[model samples]
Target: MKNKKAVVYVRLKEGVLDPQGVTIQRAILNMGYDVVEGVRSGRFFELELADGNGDLSGKVEEICRKLLANPVIEDFSVEYT
Candidate 1:
């Protein structure tokens, strides 16, 4: 069996205020770089899983919703590789 990895990506939802993103965008503009219009920040987690049945995806999704991400203010996406 091949090894697998689950990558969970977390980001603030649309219409939500992101102070870190705003700060980074301002700093970029202040540096005289007009090429950048906006910036958004996010986080990701990598989980190593044993080769098992097809239930790994579902488990990772549940983990993200329950612990890794805040469902009210943030959204999460998962990828298996």
Candidate 2:
């Protein structure tokens, strides 16, 4: 079995309030970076797969849905490399 890597990004869903993001954006503006429009706080997870071929995508998705993010408030995307 070949080893592989997967990256999972979890972020707040649309219409959800992100106070952290708002605070960061405000700080950026206060720092004179007016060009900064907004910021959204999120989570990134890197996982090593022991076996790359055994339903890798499915496993990653399951992990993201079950552990890495809150399904009701956040959405996640998976990337393999």
Candidate 3:
């Protein structure tokens, strides 16, 4: 029985138009931050699981694949700590 911590990160797939990121980068440049080359926005999720069997990773992965991420346009990664 182990208490597990999970971190899920979701990001837009490459080749997708990220207007928000582009806009932010432009704004940074305007603010005199010339070294800011690019920007990409993503999401982070931290969770704790109380499963005794040590099978939480599979379940969390499934949850991310099914609900947290759109398989066609997004990518996700899970880390257990």
In model 3, the worst 10-residue window by lDDT is: 50-59
What do the candidate models score in CA lDDT, each in turn? Answer: 0.89, 0.88, 0.88
How close to the true structure is residue 7 of candidate 2, measured as C-alpha lDDT? 87
The lDDT of model 3 is 0.88
**Which segments of candidate 2 are over 4 A away from where they belong?**
1-3
Cα deviation at 64, candidate 3, in Å, is 0.3
Clash pairs, candidate 3, are none
- What tens digits encode model 2's per-residue C-alpha lDDT throughout 1-81? 343888899999998999999999999998989898979999899998886376578777888898999999999998777
Q: Highest lDDT: which candidate? A: 1
Model 3 C-alpha lDDT per residue in residues 29-73, reported as the tens digit of each score: 999999989899989898888767666777888999998898899
TM-score of candidate 2 against the unseen true structure: 0.88
Model 1, span 16-68: residue lDDT tens: 99999999999999999999888999999999988766567777888999999
Decoy 1 TM-score against native: 0.89
